[model samples]
Target: MKVVIVDDAPRVRDRVKALLHADAPYAEVVGEAGEAQAAIRLIRDMRPDVVILDLQLVGASGIKVLRAVKLAPHAPRVIMLTNLTDLEYQITCLEAGAEYFLDKSFGFERLADILRDLARKSGPDSEERAVL
Candidate 1:
């Protein structure tokens, strides 16, 4: 399962990558970006199966990247991870086509689990599950 990590904080990106590696070995970190434009470009070029996107990016909002990803052909499943835990923000992300919206404070493990489930569903033994 190819995955992309997009976060403005280098530490956060590294932590997420490490967590994914430690918990979801089947998930591969294919690409990463810290800003909206670069993240959008990477997503378009890499065509990863999943993208761990930060809701807050460097000098830009992650929603821009999300919108671009959603507009692309064969969009990947996006999980919005943000420090901002406002209900409205979560709803906004969901409405914008994010498969999952998680608060950064406690969503790391849950994100890993989601990735694992996605990997299992995409595996040869499982039935074909269409993922966008």
Candidate 2:
């Protein structure tokens, strides 16, 4: 699996990468971006399988990044990881086309499970299951 991590805090990025590595050591960290523009550039360049983004960014916010990513060609599916628990925030992110909304306070193991689920859903066979 390939992923681009976008978080304003370097520590958050490191932590996420470590958890992902623990889950799937083979998973590649294609890129890491701290701000919106860097995130945008990384997406365009790496075109990763999935993106783990923070809701609060240094600029433009993660919501904007979600919107931008969704608009990209063959855009990577996004999962929002943040401390924000507001219903409105969740609703807005879902509306913006986020594949998952996860709380960062939770264990990385939880996110790893979600990442697997998302990958399964992205596969071709998932369409058949969706009909059921």
Candidate 3:
């Protein structure tokens, strides 16, 4: 599965990408971006299978990216990787159409497994398994 990883912190981006790549060799990380606009352009152009996004992204908020991604044709499922654990942020993200909101503090390999399962599941099945 192809993925677009967007995070403001270089270390976080690299680590997530590396971990994902290591976990699933076929999971190619097509691109990476530090801010909203660039990520938008990349997503529009690449149309990756999924997006792993960080709320602390520079320039625009990750919520905007979620909104923008939802507007795209065949919008990729978004798994929000954020440090913000507040309910407000979580609620806003769900309302905005993010598939999952994950805390960066947890084990990311588990997050990748969820992504893989989501990718493998059918529409109805995927919708039923909403835990992130």
Q: How many clashes show up in model 2?
A: 0
Score candidate 2 by lDDT: 0.79
Candidate 3 lDDT over residue span 1-132, tens digit each: 789999999999899878987786667899999999999999989999888888877789999988998897688888888889788998898877777888888847676687677678665224532434
Winner of 2 and 3 under TM-score: 3
Candidate 2: tens digits of C-alpha lDDT, residues 1-132: 789999999999999989888886656889999999889989988989889888888878899999998887687777788888688888898777777777777735577776677666645223221100
lDDT at residue 89 of model 2 (Cα atoms): 84
What's the TM-score of each model vs. the native?
0.88, 0.88, 0.91
Query: lDDT (CA) for every model shown?
Result: 0.82, 0.79, 0.82
lDDT of 1: 0.82
List where candidate 2 sits over 4 angstroms from the true fold.
122-132
Winner of 1 and 2 under lDDT: 1
Tell me how far the alpha carbon of residue 92 in candidate 2 is from the true structure, in angstroms, after superposition: 0.5
- TM-score, ranked from best to worst: 3, 1, 2
